[model samples]
Target: MVQAYILIQTDMGRAGDVSAACAEIDGVVSAEDVTGGYDVIVKVEANTVDELGKLVLAKIQKVQGIVRTQTCTVVHV
Candidate 1:
């Protein structure tokens, strides 16, 4: 299984809503609103790297208030 963390940047003042929406998506295991360079952080898992990429691109990124995202795949080693 592929696992990744998605760092999201959203429109100002929309972090809470964005985080809530992210938590509802199929691949998102968890999501939280945070204070820092990014607005929200999401944990996701999929069958493959490409599938994870599509989940981020086609779903999470489509959520309202999301402005940009950075994905970091977890490395077991």
Candidate 2:
């Protein structure tokens, strides 16, 4: 599986709602409200890299309160 950590930014006071929505997405393993530049941090997995991109673009990004996201793909060396 392809795994990544998605750092999400949300509209002010919407972190809880955004994280909750992301947590329910099929590929999302976990989503939590967080502090710092990003509001929510999500762990997600998909069958392939393409699917990962799709999950981010077609699913997670579509969450109502999400403003922006940065995907950090996991790599094994």
User: Which candidate achieves the best TM-score against the true structure?
Assistant: 2
Candidate lDDT values, in order: 0.95, 0.94
Model 2: how far is 22 from its true place, Å?
0.6
Pairs that collide, model 1: none
lDDT of 1 by residue, 1-77 (tens): 99999999999999999999999999899999999999999999999999998999999999999999999999992
**Candidate 1, after superposition: displacement of residue 54 in Å?**
1.0
How close is every model to the real structure, measured as TM-score? Answer: 0.96, 0.96
lDDT of 1: 0.95
Decoy 2 TM-score against native = 0.96
Give the range of the ten consecutive residues with the poorest summed lDDT in model 2. Answer: 68-77
